[model samples]
Target chain A: MRQDIIEIRWHGRGGQGAITAAKVVANAVFKAGYKGVVMAPTFGTERRGAPVFTSLKISREKIYDLSPIETPDMVVVLDHTLLEEVDVTHGLKDGGQIILNTPKAIDTYDFGAHKLSISDVTSHALEAGLAPGIVNTGIIGAFAKATGLVSRDLLREAILNEFSVMKPEENARAAALTYDRTVIGGA
Target chain B: MHVIESGNVAAATGVKLARTQVIAAYPITPQTPLTEKLSEFVESGDLPAEYIPVESEHSAMAVCIASSTAGARSFTATSANGLLYMNEQLHWAAGARLPIVMCVANRGVGAPWTVWNDHQDTVSQRDLGWIQLYCADHQQIHDTVLKAFKLAETVSIPVMVCYDGYLLSHTYMPFDVPEQEKVDAFLPGFEPTHFLNPEKPRNFNTVTLPDVRPDLHGNTAPGYMEIRKTLHTDLRAALSEIEKIDGEFGEIFGRGGEPFLEPYCCDDADYVAFCMGSLSYQLRDVVDAMREEGIKVGVMGLKVYRPFPDAAVREALSAFKGVIVLEKALSYGNQGALYADVKSALYSAETRPFVHNYIVGLGGREIKTQHLYDALTESINKEAAVGDEPRWIGLKL
Candidate 1:
């Protein structure tokens, strides 16, 4: 659903790397020739494992407003449990898209009015030697492949440039694995 | 070269490019990243400056004052409580006329404890006699720092380059990073008019009486009265110098903002909004949207808050029948600080505009472009009460 001006909302708990993912994507989008990019986390100072969100806007035109995005073109869920906890598609456009981290196949989930993209980014993270939680960056690889909104090379570069993990190559590998393994449905 | 930078890093970059001599800093949210970047630069030898690791914000300001007294181009940055803590030194720096430049990542004043964006911190210190420059974006922050040093050094008045915390402080945008040689050509080396040295020990304002006094060399010098008079006079005089310096910078660097204020679509404006900082960017967009709706809306962004551009503001507001003063800071019992400033500036105008003051986005509360339209609509609909309290917008009753 990326267009001239696309607003993306990311759903994840605190410490799940939602904010970092948003920044990385925005930076990558900038690297991919779309100049105006903005990303911001929710205003709450800090609380781990709490329901939180981050929003990003990548545009071909110069963006003036600093206000947080109200309606999103795409929503990425870093935490799967957030599906039951909150209305993830609160102000989404009619033909908006949803990219999620889940084990269920493309046929199992009913994503109301959204073109669904599924990736087991968590498994990729585990393969990359990461902990059980926080599949934020890994999901971005699937995001790039499923939507074609961002470049794969730029996604890998963004993860490597931004993420300061123990084994950064692992983060890059996780992104690549998820990008190839992602399945699209109900477009 | 063009680079995508956050506000904090942009500021740090400015300090680095200006080649500040002494950077005394203490960490605080939003502003911590800026000082940390400076620390990294200092450690990496990219910025060859003495980076002081101070105990508190109080000590940080004290270090700047001490360094400035020793004739070093000094720089320091802090936020809300840190700025509040340096209140006494803030006066001392301005009173002593040290051309120290500091970046105040504008934040809300804490009472119940909040670390969000607002002008309460910087606006509260408007009385302390420092030239305050507010930036709308990272580009401005970068360019202004170069200009600020020149302005500060030329006028011998300290300057506070302020921007909204978290909003500009954390947000990213691509901006033209000026070449080092170009910056060097634009901003000259620091020249201290007077300093304390042991070998050539000249007494510098130990205890000036109310009137003029003679020095050891039998040269007559003005005392406290004249010193205070010169401070105000020089600040007022810098208005022209601000424009001149901005013009010169623009000519060389290819980008410079009007140091005092920027008027947007105000030529035929009947109703205008008065604002400053990042919110002004949003206000400009809101003005465009309202114009599409045929509201005749215009926006004038106040870039310089200190030595308040009274004449420019008066002229800008004179064309409009209604001028809504929107600010991120509040004055609690009284009206918003900026509203009072606007009211006073327009007090003597022949055609006094109806000025409505409102505070929004305090403590970094979300303010959308829609809120601007709402504020303007309500201000236009409501009657002008000359002596009433300024309304607080977006409060849940």
Candidate 2:
């Protein structure tokens, strides 16, 4: 891995829109002038409610490697329930950031030597009048606040662009609300 | 306009820009989104073309053949078993000399039934007489598709633009979509020399005797063997046309130069990694790592596969000390198809490099950079002693 590249792994259920979320972030960051951005979903046979993951990589130069990211700088959990069955932190870097869409407090989880951020994105999505448990856009707000890789405005714009026909304003609002409610904890 | 989109959307955008007259495709995994997007484009009036929702891949191809034979520019797409189902139509499209274009989201075939990325589908159809072009990224997916229409129309042979099923098809990346006017300038309307006309009814692909015979007007016509020979000769001639069209595309779009082979850092290296599709791009990372460790290595991507580009392959690779041929498909019992081709191409060269084959990532298996690095390093260390037997990487049998 290049030192300048930031790799992220997103964990969620098959129907939970993790792949779309990664794509949104990739779009936002690419608009932010990171020239190289790639988002790839786990290949083959994804069933709804079954655990699925997608990887995103961003860098200044063009990225040629299409291989899955073995060690990610950040791990995003779209559904906290996935944490029990899936080790979302399997190959996370030592000081990596872990963002979770959980109702629990950040201190309740102990990920050694890494930063933690928590946002109840499911609640945020509901509050924003989105479908129940559609926390994909909301999690992007937490990601923006925790890593500062992309701006909230840019993410909101990307969400609107991606969901233009399906409640674009509501998804942008969900992302904004989740961004404000995201709590970041020290390593 | 610059946008971040999937490789399928990129291909569809190219089709729309080319102003395709008709599109007929059956829904299949990976390739479904491309045709679905094309349907959306047609329904939304973003593209004024006829969109046919066919029952099966065979019917989809049949629609293309019929439409193309009527002098309408047509397109279709398929993958895995879907491509296999259209095997007979594939040859018919070529032999009948229809200028149709199809995109193959390359996937592994099955009795095991897998919907994953591999080259088995297209590689198995290598002899079916379609011009095969492989894309390594989203931009190439868009660019190659646009170029394929021109090449196919120029040679009167159907073209298949193939890219890895999930790797490139599903992944989202940034690519510049060329302006419609510019694309129009680069590729003109399809004007076939001969097409079906209702006023003057003619027979196409009718059964013929083994020996040459005279037609109703006493004009001598070619026999079956001669017709087959013409197709072979024309396919060989299309190689230069491919290069010329690519050069013209580059002049207009400013994004192409290497038409047949896209070589990265091979000018000063002694060893090069060779493959088709995304694997060649993936090996770039391994090449970088090896370069840092004092190993002179580069990677070359075979963009045009069917014409084989034997002369180009020999010319580019003859200077290297070793060529590591990594592929996602195999010939089952013999060896990697690309490995055999590389060796055969290098057979007449005064100095032949040690060519080794490593089959990797069949059935969507994870292809790690570390494994590729290890394989290339081992091959380089052993040099000519790396034997002729094809090696398997990341195997856990």
Candidate 3:
């Protein structure tokens, strides 16, 4: 397949930092001298544990339309339970990749994608003494490995810009571990 | 200094400049970013305030009421369903007469839910006894927040600073955020004479006996009579305070649109259109085009919706042959509610013009300038038909 702009759809709960993940990705794209549209399609009252989806459209051109992406190029499931909550693979294009946050085997569920379970994301974060909320940074690292859409240097720069002020060294360690263990499943 | 900012950010900056001490809010569409930005200020140590992440909109208003009564400059914001959810405390905020400034990003209330710009949310709260100030642009959003605090505190009533949901909330424009020290000098910290302090405990909303009931109004009796008089008097008081606060704010902020009614091309016109909220800006554009074509039409925007600003409206509209009231909200029985009030204001004038009411947007429907232009074009033909009652623009069959 020809390499082009990568569109990512993030699925997770409200307080799971899904929105922040999209922003980090956008910031990464922006630092790469590209454009990224970070949009969160929120509904009803903001309740904890409610399923929330945020989208990031990273392109070399200016991103204008913010509507829901019918066919996302890459789908990052921040919460594994959201798979049963809605059809996560509804309009996912063929040859697209799915990055499940769980460690279970990809074929354990019938989700129709070349799936890889980045299960070590949480444990590695915990190993680094980073709390559970840093899974998003791990997801970014796995995303960079899976898609190769963004440079590791650019993603590292974006993560540092975002979280370096809060928890710097632990997140940098988490990003390094994530970049190493993210293995590609069957295509 | 002029900075490019979203309407939500602009309003938040206004609240920060006003030195709001407490912000209790639950996030809602078109309004979440306003509070989110304020929360950022609190987190970044830029603004020193209590940002309470409330459970629901009801609790949001409750927090605002309690905090404001305790001598704090409190603020909260919501849109659509969130405002409707805060229904009961809306009455409490007014009944207790707390001067809480709320920014209402006007949205459509739902059954079949929608998240778009409309006047349903703010318009439905017209009878809640709070002063309503509709804004036209980003500058007005900043001006209205500062003025609203003064008006609310002066009238001893709450005030709603309303703007179109997405039109103003999401759009970015150049905003002039005043210096904090200058704003502090303009609006000193509020110190309440009566607070829920442990040392000076007092009953807030207690039941009164019949004999003492009449004392609330003194000259006027109790029930609807006294309530109406109090509302009218308080609303009139709010209008004067609105003008006075605008003058002071103008001195500090250096931009002064009319604090009450903004008249556009009304001087030498035979016909005029009355609109509120962001539509007035759209109407002004139409008025300019019509003026260039020598249509002799003008635009009048109502900012203070409570006191009705009757005199200002009558003086500006009396010279026209007919007046067109473009309403986004409706009263089931009569004409557009504001049109009825405007008619009452114009009734005794010597040369009263004919009034036409065009109800265009209800459930967050898009209202184009052409729709307004079409309504005016129709009114020009049917001016004589409108005697006392007004006409609807795009009523559903």
Candidate 4:
């Protein structure tokens, strides 16, 4: 793990748009002036409801290392059930952040020394007039609010850009609502 | 405009900016998105080109051959087994001297049924007489595709713009899309020297006798063997033309200079790691980490693989204390293809370095930075351990 690059691992199912969320975040961060940003989905035959993961790396300098991240600085879980299906906390650095899309309170789960942040992104998306289970864009809002690494406006802009032909306004609203509802807890 | 997008989109944008007239391809993983993007551009009327949804990779290349011979700037893309399926047309395309450009999202050849990134696909097609160019990142994928069209037209040869499948193809990164006007200025409209036209009817690649024969004008026409020799000679000569186009392209795009080889931290290093494609970029991080520990090592990426850049390779590697040739493809019975080539290139040099071969990331096996670091460290310390056989990394068996 290079000290200069921040590595993030994203967990979700095949059709949950985890890979799309990773790309949107990479775009937002790059536009926010991070010179180097890379997002790569796990390579394989992906089936619906199958456990899958993707990685995102961001840095101020150019990134030449394309190897899979063995130890990530943060872990983002798009579904709370993924915590049981997969070891979402594996290879997470001590005191690293775990941003989860869950309706439960942060203290409900014990993640050891890692910081925990929870947001009901699925609920937020549904409340914002989006179709059921469309929480990929809303999850970015939770990431932004929890880490404060990227601004909300930039995330909204990226969301709109990604979903321009689709429900762009609904996606942006879902992200905004999630951003306001994200709760950050100490390690 | 600079934007973060998939490498497939980057390649599509380059093809659009080049104003390609015809595109025909069969969908293959890692390469399907590139053609899909081009099809979108065509359907949306963004790019005015004929999009042919061919049934197979063979037909895809045949369409390019027919279109290119008719003086159309043609393009296509494919992956591992798909590329192998077009083997016959690939030879015909080069032998007939059609200036078509194809993008190969390099993938592992299948037997156990895996669609993953590896160099086995293009490396196996080394002798098919196509000018092969490897890219290390998304920007290079865009830039090289544009340059491939120009270089192919200049030499009257087909070109394969190759980058690692899934590694570069599916990854999202930032790359600048050069303006259409700038690309047009760099690459003029396709005016082929010889083409199939109703005004000037002539046969191309017709059968000839074994020896020299007289033509209609009583001049000696080259026989079959002579034609092959000419194709060989011209392909070798195109190496210099490649350098020239690279120089001119750099002057226009602000991203050239290293036409055949892109070196990093090799100015005063004793050891150099050599490979093709994005693996070279990955080794750059290893080189930097090793340099921190007072190891004088660097990395050199071989961008142009066909016509074998022997001179540039010899010149860059002859002065090093050691050279590690790490690659994804092997020659099966002998050693790594790149390792064999590098050794042969340095054979005639006055001073040769200790070159070792390492095979890694076959069939999309995970390539860890730690594995690379350990391999390099061992190669540096235990030079006595070097042998004719290539060492395999991450081989659980």
Best by TM-score: 4
User: Candidate 1 lDDT, tens digit per residue, A1-187?
Assistant: 1236689999999888888888788878887888777776776466998888888888987776878878899999886788899899889888788999998887888867888899999998898777777587788988898779888889988888886665678888888889999998875
As for DockQ, the candidate ahead, 1 or 4, is 4
lDDT of 1 by residue, B87-130 (tens): 99999999999999999999998896779999999999998889
Give the per-residue lDDT of model 4 (tens digit) for A1-187: 3679999999999999999999889988998889999888888688999999999999999888887777898999999988888999899999999999998988899988999999999999999999999989999899999989889999999999999999999999999999999999999
- The CAPRI category of model 2 is medium
Off by over 4 Å in 3: A1-187, B213-232, B383-397
TM-score of each: 0.93, 0.98, 0.67, 0.98
Higher-scoring candidate on TM-score, 1 or 3: 1
Residue B353 displacement (Å), model 4? 0.6
User: How close to the true structure is residue A171 of candidate 4, measured as C-alpha lDDT?
Assistant: 95
Question: Whole-model lDDT for model 3 versus the true structure?
Answer: 0.76
lDDT, ranked from best to worst: 2, 4, 1, 3
Q: Flag regions of model 2 displaced more than 4 Å.
A: B383-386
- Higher-lDDT candidate of 1 and 4: 4
TM-scores for chain B, in order? 0.97, 0.99, 0.92, 0.99
DockQ of 4: 0.79
lDDT of 3 by residue, A1-187 (tens): 1134466788878788776666666766666666423343443355788887766666675332333466787788876777889666667778777777766655576544445545457767777678866687777777777777668888787778778677876776676687778767765
RMSD of each: 2.6, 1.3, 9.3, 1.1
User: What docking grade applies to model 4?
Assistant: medium
TM-score of 3: 0.67
- Model 2 lDDT on a 0 to 1 scale: 0.93
**Winner of 2 and 4 under TM-score:** 4
Error of 1 at A61 (Å): 1.9
